[model samples]
Target: MTTLSSATPRVSPWVLSAFWFGTAFHWLLLLLILMPHDVVRFVGEGQKGTYLGVLTAVGAVMALVLPPLIGARSDRSGRRLPYIRLGVGVNLVGLAVMALAASALAGMGGFWVYVLGFLLVQFGNNYATAPYSALIPQLVPPEQRGRYSGVMGLLQAVGQLLGAVTAFAVGLLKLPVLVSFALIALVLLVPALITLRGVREEGGAAVQAPRGPTLTWRQLFAYQPFLWVFVTRVLFALGQYSVQPFLQYYNADVLKQRDATTSTSIMLLCIIVGSIVSALIGGRISDRVGRKPVIYVAGTAMALAALLLLVAPSYPVALALAVFFGLGFGAFTSVDWALGSDAMPSASSYARDMGIWHVAFVAPQLSSAPQGALLDWGNAQGGNLGYTLVFGIAALFFLLGVILVRNVPEMVGRRPLTQPDGNL
Candidate 1:
């Protein structure tokens, strides 16, 4: 039988920060690329949302199954590196395939190749993220998780800024789209490589053996607090995801802006700024008060932002709304993981639990495609009613998200794994 440490050793501050930076950079880079701008460019205006949504939905199906299974396997074996390394290899290959597909569609378009490429990217990245997030509980002591989460939020802000800047730079240089994407891959890979090399988990010396009866889906979801978190997340995520991919399209198609890229970039820039401020403060605040209150505040702020967008007359007004939304989202991002860490059903199944929790984000993608179809449907009816309706629904979801978490217990500023320690 293998022996494992009772307590997880805390990771050094600098190394953990660098790891966060690398992970954020990689994720933000992918998000920027997958935004509506690229999709509309290839698939055309009328169908871009639906096409992108469809592709995302299709890919999400694969992502839904893979992460949890992989995370569970890692839990059993007491290793994340091997899986993470495999993810990196898969991700690189997926990016290469995507670049090739994008190149082929330089003229009119080709759907299947691009779809396949995207699916592979989803599979690779989601595989990596499960293990990546699982590291948080291992690295940060529970008392300081809020602070660590804050730092992560700051890195995420920086990464968002970097991703937007890179996108603008690619456009300004007028590089071939495929080449631009390739450059992004290179940029993300640098820090990822560093993270892989530099950050090492403790307890590798003694591998963990699975303890107790096997975890089951039914038993896992039965944990009420986790269920509440998942429900709130899925609702808010649906609202947020439904709106994001449509922003650029709404600007160019409905608002009729020739400089759509610049406009979009400005809004994104504002979001980055807002996220930076909240991320720095929100996590620390949650530590003192509680995660639920912070999330409530964040959700309300986001709802207000959505309402403002629904009524805004011009791009400038929309820009202002973006800032508010960013602030809210930034705060939520900072505290959410800390809360998840607190609410985990089992320490042994951290990665697996996180993987299941990830479905809140993933399931929303499936709705996004249908939401796009809804947008197209609304436009067909005239008066841009579709956009208005969608924004309202988004706001409603945010509001409901705030309310749903009201009853869930808070776990801020408490030690993690109080129940028992596993080999991991």
Candidate 2:
């Protein structure tokens, strides 16, 4: 297990969280705008939702399997930055391949080619992210985790905001698809470079020695706090994914927006604004008050916002509801990493544990993939009932997250499981 000394110098939270901006930028741009736009172009409006769902679902398979394996490899090797660098290079290659498919091909052939690229992107991103997720737990003390998590949330919100702006510009100006892809690669590269340069991992005995046996699946499941955290995250993510992938379609089909891309970007801008504010506030507040209280508030806010969005009378009203949703999301994001860190059963396998935790994020993509068909079916039946059904489900998931989180006891200021007498 990695241990921190009281005399160890503290790194700035911003420096530690720098890579998150790039990560958030890459995914938000791809998921919220680029991929959806491409799916619509390739598959036509009638089947866009179904096609997009299938593509994301297929890509999610790679996302689910690769992270834990890569993370375990990095954990064993006692190295992280090299893996991050390699992952970035592979991710860029995937992005370039996707650009080629978008620019050169048409129809299902192009979509299939894009799918291959998406798989690579998922694999590469998760490869980096699994190890990267260990930084906070490895570096920061328990008392300071809330502040570090807050910084992460802040950067993520900013990244998403920038991604929204980029999407809007691309759609409004009719920029070449390659140009947008290039922008994603550029944004992704810079922050990763910064993180590689700025953050330093402790070397020698602390990292090289195995604390004990590597945790088995059975042993992992026996840790009730970790299980609860994983379950709560899964439910929260399900609610989020249910709404996220279908927003552009919602704008076009339900709101009758002529330029759905631009509209979605605008809505995202509003959401990100709310997220930024809450992220900055929520993390600091959690440090003082506790993680669960903040999470409870956040989940309720999101659940209410989801419900409100369902009955929103107009596009403007929907945008307002989106801001409310963002507040909850940002607050949740701020404390989520800290909570997971607190619940982890082992300190020696930070990356591996975090990689398994990451499944909570991608599993939802797989779970919610069928919602695309539901959206199509509901639209086919008239009144766009699919949107309502999905959003309602989202609300339910959020509420469940609020409830299940209670099972994980707060470990703030407590000694981690690395100590023989420590309790999780």
TM-score of each: 0.91, 0.95
Please tell me which predicted candidate would have the highest lDDT against the true structure: 2
Candidate 1 residue-wise lDDT, 1-424, digit = tens: 2223224433544445554565566555555444455677677777876776777678879878888888887777666666777776677777787778776766444556666777777787778777766767655656667777777788878877777677667666777867756765776567667666655544444334224333477766776767888899988898787787677777776566787775666677888888988986998998888888899999999999987887788888888888989999999988887877776766677778888888877888788778888888888789887888778889999999999989677766544333442211
lDDT of 1 at 326: 92
* C-alpha RMSD (angstroms) for model 2: 2.4
How far in Å is the alpha carbon of 157 misplaced in model 2? 0.2
TM-score top scorer: 2
Q: What is candidate 2's lDDT per residue for 1-424, written digit by digit as tens?
A: 2332222325578877889999999999999899999988888888888889988888888889988899898878767788899999999999999999999867788888898888889878988988888777767777888888999999999999999999999988999999999999999999999888876655532333224345776777677878889999999999998889989988887778899999999999999999998997898898898899999999999999988887788999989988988999999999988888776676667788889998888889986569898888888888989998888999999999999999888888754465443333
What is the alpha-carbon lDDT of model 2 when measured against the actual structure? 0.85
Give the whole-model CA lDDT for all candidates, comma-separated: 0.73, 0.85
Report the Cα lDDT for candidate 1: 0.73
The ten-residue window of minimal lDDT in model 2 covers 1-10
